[model samples]
Target chain A: MTNVLNKAINEKPVTTGMLLALMAATAYGSSQFLAKQIVTEIAPPSVVATVGLFSGFVVLMGLSIGNLPKDRKAPKKAVVFLILSGIASSAGVTFLYTALELAPVVIVAPVSSVTPLISLSLAHIFLPKMESITAKTWVGAILVVAGVSLITIGSHI
Target chain B: MTQAIIFALLAALGWGTSAIFVRLGLQNLTATPGTAISLAVGTILIGIVAVTAHGPTAFNLNPNEFAWIVLLGVLNYVLGRYLNFNSVNLAGISRSAPLLASAPLVAVAMGILIGGETINSFILLGTLSIFGGVILVATGGGRG
Candidate 1:
C-alpha cells in the first residue's frame, strides 16, 4: 500500500491523473454550488437544468463530433442503452437541480453522493460477470448507507 | 426537507442506474463517444421537456447569468468529465476514483465557506462517513 502510494505520488502520469481528478471534482462541486445559486436566486430549477445541460451537450457534441459516425457503426442495442442511460442521466440532473432548489448544497450533496453505492449494486445485479464485487465494497456500502441514514435522521431532528 | 432528501436519492438512483446502462452500452464503445451519445440523448429528454413543458418563457434570463450557466455547463459536463475519463485511463480507477469521489467534499466545503451554510454534528459525522465509505469503495474497485 505504501509502495503504491509512493509510486503514484512520484510518477508523472499518476500525478497528472490525480491532478485532473481533483480538478474534475472541483468543477463538479462548483457546478453544484453554482446550480444552487442559480436555482435559488436566479431562475427556476427546470430552467437551470435545461440551460446548463443543453450548453454542456453543445460542447460535448462538438468535442465528440468525430466519433459521431462511430455510433452508427455500433450495435443498435448499444445505441438504445446509451439513449436510456442518457435519459437517466438527465433525470439525475433534473432531480439534483430540484434538490438544490429546495435545500442547501451541503445537505443535498452528501445524500446524493451515494451514487457509487447505487452503481455498485446495479453492477452487481445486472453485470455480475463484468463486475467483481469485493467484501470491501459491501463494507463500504454499509458505512455509506449508515451515514446517509444518520444524515436523514439528523435532518429530521 | 424530506422532499429534498427524496429528490437527492432519486438523483442518485438515476445516476446509479445510468452507470449500468453505460456499462452495457460501452461493451461496444469507448468512454468519450459513449458519454457524448448518452448526454445528448439525456439532454433531449429532460432539457427539451424542461423548456417545452414549462413554456417558452421558462428560460428567461440575463446575459450574465446565461453566460455563467454556459461556462459551468462546459466546466462540469465537458471539461470535468473529460478530465475524469482521461485520469481513469492514466492512473487507473483505484487512484482516480477516490479523488473523483471527493466531489461531495468539495461541495460541502464550498457550501460552508462560500454559500454560508451551517452544519450540525450528526450531519458532519455522516458526511465524513459517507466520504470515507466512498473512498473505500473506490479503492476496492469497480471497472466503471
Candidate 2:
C-alpha cells in the first residue's frame, strides 16, 4: 500500500497536478464556507473583503516574495496585463463575497462557478489566437444555464 | 434574491475576464510573479474600497470573526489559487479543469452540511447539472 501510494505521488506533473487541483477545490470550497461565516450583517462584505484580501495578499507575498524581483524584469506588457487581471479579480471577489452575504451558498457557488463559460467565450472573442472553442463547449454552456435555472426554481420552491 | 444573482453574474464576468488577462500575461511571464503582481494590485484596489466604504471600522471584529477572516484569506487566496496555478502548470488545463469545476460541489455540500442551508431535489439536480456542464465546458476548451 505504501509503495503504491509513494509511486503515485512520485509521478511527475500528472499525479502532482491532480493532487494540487483536488487540494485547490477543497480550499476554495472551504473559503466560501469561511466567507459565509464572516459576511453577516455585523460585518459587511466590504469589511470582510478588506481584511481577507489583505491577509491573503500578505500571506502570499511571504511565500512568493522571492519572485518580486523577477516581476520587475518581466515585459511591461505582461505587467500591465497582470495589473488588469488583478483589478478584475478584485472585482470578482468583492461581488462574490457580497452575493454570499445575501444568498445561500447553493445559489452563489453554482452561479459564480459559471466563470468558465464566460471565460471561454471571451477567449474566443478576445484571445482567439490562443484558444478555440467547439460546439461541445456551447452545449455545456446551455447545460449550465439550464442547471442554474433549475437551482433558481428550486430556491424559490 | 435579485441582488445576489446580479452580483454573482458580475463576479463571473470579472473572474472570466481576469482569466483572459492572466493568459495574456503568461505569454511573456510565469504564473507566480504574474499572480503575485496581479494580486498585489487587487489588494490595493480592494483596500481603497474597504476604506471608502467602512472608513477603517472593519478592524473592530471580535477574535472569532478575525480568525475566520484570516483563515479565509489564507485558504482561499493562498492555498486555493496557488494550488490551482500549479495544477494547471503541471497537469495541463484539461485534466485539472474538471477537478477545479468540482469546487462548487464541495461548497454546496459544506453549505448544506455545516452552513445549515436547506435543499431539495431541484437544488441537488441543478447543482449536479452545473457541475457536469462546467466539467464539459472547461475540458472541452482544448487542453491548456
Candidate 3:
C-alpha cells in the first residue's frame, strides 16, 4: 500500500485522463444548476435528454475523428457493454435533469451526491475483487445517504 | 421537500451507477467511439420514448429552446462525459466521485450570485452538513 501510494505520488504531476476526469466532474456538477435553469423554460425531461445527448454525441464524434485508436475495430463484447452502459447513463441523466427541472439546484444536487455509495455498493455486490466495502466505507455511505436526506428536508423550505 | 429529495436521491443513484458503467464500457472501446455510441444509443432511446408518448413532433422546439438544449448538452454531456471518464481512469472513482459531488456547493454559489436566490437557515445548515460530511468521507481516504 505504501509502495502504491509512493508510486502514485511520484508519477508525473498529472495525467491527461485524470485532468479530463476532474474537468468532467466539475462540468457535471455545475450542470445541475444549469439544467435547473434551462428546464424551467423547457418543459419535457425527454426533450432535454434527447437534445443534450445528440449534441454531446456530435461533439464527441467530431473530437474523436482524428484520434481513433490505431488498432482493431471495437469488440462486439465491448459494444454490448457500451449499450448497457448507455442505458444506465441515459437513465441517470433523465432522472437528474428531471429532478433539476422540478427542484432547486441545491435540493437536487445532494441526491446525486450519494452516487458513490450506490456505485460502491453495486461494485461490492457485482465486482467483489475491484472494491472492498470496509466499515469506514459503510459509515461514509450512511453519511452520504443521510446528508442527502437532510438536503431533501431543506428543499421543502 | 420529501418528493424533491427522493427525486434527487434517485438521480444520484443513477448518476453514480452511470459513472461505474462508463468506466466499464470505456474499457471495451475507444474513448471517442465509446462516448459517441453511448450518447447516440441514449438519445435514440429517449427520442423513441418521447415520440411514442407525445407523437412525431416530440422533438419539435423553437430555436431559442433548441440553442439552450444544445449548449447544455454539449457542455454537460459531451465535455463533461469525456472529462469524467478520464478522471475515473486516472484518479479512480474514490477520489473523483466525491469531488464531482461538490458541484452542489458551486450551484449554491451560482444560485446566490445569478439566480438572486437566498439561503435560509435550514438550507444553510443542511448545505454545511452536506459539505462537512463530504469532507469527512473524502479525507477518510487517507491520501487527500
Which candidate number has the best TM-score? 1
For residues A102-146, could you state the per-residue lDDT of candidate 2 as single tens digits?
999988898889999999989988877777887779889988999
True contacts kept of 3: 0.58
Single out the weakest 10-residue window by summed lDDT for candidate 1 chain B. Answer: B135-144
Residues B49-142, candidate 1: write the lDDT tens digits.
Answer: 7777778687778899899888878888888888788789778889889999889989999999999998888889889899989888777755
Quantify all predictions' global Cα lDDT against the true fold. Answer: 0.84, 0.84, 0.70
**Which stretches in model 3 have alpha-carbon errors above 4 Å?**
A1-26, A67-72, B85-98, B132-144
* TM-scores, each model vs. reference: 0.92, 0.91, 0.81
Here the TM-score of candidate 3's chain B is: 0.73
Supply the TM-score for candidate 3: 0.81
DockQ of 3: 0.46
What CAPRI grade goes to candidate 3? acceptable
lDDT of 3 by residue, B14-123 (tens): 65666566667677677778877788889999878777877768677889889988888888866776667656767776666656656677777776778777666667
Q: Candidate 2, after superposition: displacement of residue A89 in Å?
A: 0.8
Error of 2 at A54 (Å): 1.7
- Highest-DockQ candidate: 2
Q: List, for all models, the DockQ compared with the true complex.
A: 0.68, 0.70, 0.46
What is the TM-score of model 1 when looking only at chain B?
0.90
lDDT of 2 by residue, B1-144 (tens): 768878988999999999999988988887766777777787788888888887877668888778888888889877888889888978889889999999988998999999899888988888888898999899888633
What C-alpha RMSD separates each model from the true structure?
4.3, 2.7, 5.8
Model 3 error, position B64 (Å):
2.3
